[model samples]
Target: MPEASPWDGISVPAHTDYTVRQVPGPTAVPCFWGRDRSGACLFILDLDGDHTDQYRKNTTTINGIDVDLRGEAGRQRLVLTLEEQIDRDLFGGLCSTLIAALGNASDAPTSLAVALAHIRRWKTFLSGRAAHHLTPEQVRGLFAELVFLEEMLDRGGTAPAAVQAWLGPEMSHQDFIFGNTAVEIKSLSGTERSTVRISSEDQLESLNDNLFLRVYRLSDLPDAAGARSLNDQVVRIQARLAAPEQIESFDRKLVLHRYAPLPEYDAPLLVVSAVRTFRVAGDNFPRLARSGLPEGVARVAYDIRIEALAPFECDNDLVFGGGNG
Candidate 1:
């Protein structure tokens, strides 16, 4: 049996045109969580009036998600049916976000306005596919940056500034730079979790800025609790950005990172348990500096063995001096 929905107990007057509900979970959005009659995790929203024409004009495929419009006159419903081939975590997050923002509200005009705005944004993302194809390398790089942002939030950093300043693909070397500190994030997967890939010698050559290396050992565990996808992390970070300008900046950064508001990132689930940080300064840190490398090697990239670099390991908090990271 499906779990009770969060909107199950919400009551409405008999004369009301429609009401909203959701499948029970700790989700931040109002949406059904269980399988549909056809046995798929589904999301359904009921609008008060007919939206047939609107849905017909706006219907478009996004990352294999099928948007369907149903219901009779005087009451219309929008159903976002999920496909089995896409990443389930991202799909679920999309449903949760849309449902929570558009449904379970008494004000019809306000709900419709918000829904239209979101739809326009989605359309724009779909149209920009040619310009922003999310590559595997970009996904991994962005994932590292996201994990760092999550860590910063956990450490009580100012969210608006921290999230806005996350320079993932924007900067060539450092993933994030705040004040005089530059953080290089490397995410590694596979059974060994043994190597960190350095993109270029210049990445670790920033001598003037305080440097730190954040290593995330991530793996895909189908049943792991608290695992979050790139999209999931994005949502969590957006909640912290209270200022409009900060939120806009974060959105722009997402585009630069090739992270469209789509449900097919194929993004690895973050292993919150396997996060580690190390101070990359001093002689103990193992790296190839630009000045030390051979004159012929310009854009040198190499993998450093994790086991060999254990001597310089430090607590996660130590890199940020125990305050906001």
Candidate 2:
């Protein structure tokens, strides 16, 4: 016989205060269908209310999703509502993201934070604003972040601190920042890792500071059995954040990256073959800098040949794995 669906053989009990029905389809949590004060159908995801003080301040609305935190510690629930006209698949995708973020936990405050993050992403997506597409550059950048995260975790760094290093915005000259050190990552596809694009004069302009460039040479695998997606890496990182506040902070960072809660990254299987780290110091490290330009030259970007940069290439241990110390 075929496997039974999660929504199969469901029953609703007779209740006096409110009517509750099981949400349809597969889900990580047992969501319930119910009516809100407006008598509109709302899907409820229950959470432990242990630390609900932060969210109790106000109702935050991003896009169309309303993050309604209800009740105290023992009876906390996150109520989500949408128009009946919305597509079912999109709604289900949003729920899946919530489930992934909640990670089978009943803790209220922490779960609430993550749920809010997921909702924000979905709100952007469902609002019909997101591109629903991950460019090759974006995918490469995400892979680099994941690699950085893996390396940091392997070396016994705290998840909260490591996650804070992921500076994903376009404004940040570097991809990561920990303490006084900044790391700029460059990823190239295919075997021939020829050159890397430096986005601005400041990207490599930190002459006296602890700036590092991490390069990754990647290729796409066809039908690789053990391959993992971006979502998989995200789950791995999220698991390492032991504290509730840490997990919540991680989610916030992900939001800043403009990463919406999608079912999964639809990109190809990215495989990294070579990883190299270079300390961006000394005169031998050839590149453009603010001091090099005469004047009025800004937003300057150029490509650097990898072959000539051999002198600056150093062991990955120098940057990660506690070699920097």
Top-lDDT structure, candidate number = 2
Backbone clash total, candidate 2:
2
Model 1 spans with C-alpha error above 4 angstroms: 1-138, 190-193, 266-268, 323-325
TM-score of each: 0.61, 0.82
What is the per-residue lDDT of model 2 for residues 18-45, given as tens digits with 9 covering 90 to 100?
A: 3567655444445675554444445677
Q: What is the lDDT of residue 145 in candidate 2?
A: 79
- Candidate 2 — what's its lDDT? 0.68
Top-TM-score structure, candidate number: 2
Q: Give RMSD (Å) of candidate 1 vs. truth.
A: 9.0
By summed lDDT, the worst window of 10 consecutive residues in model 2 runs over 4-13
Candidate 1: Cα lDDT at 2: 61
Query: RMSD per prediction, one decimal?
Result: 9.0, 4.2
lDDT score at residue 307, model 1, on the 0-100 scale: 76
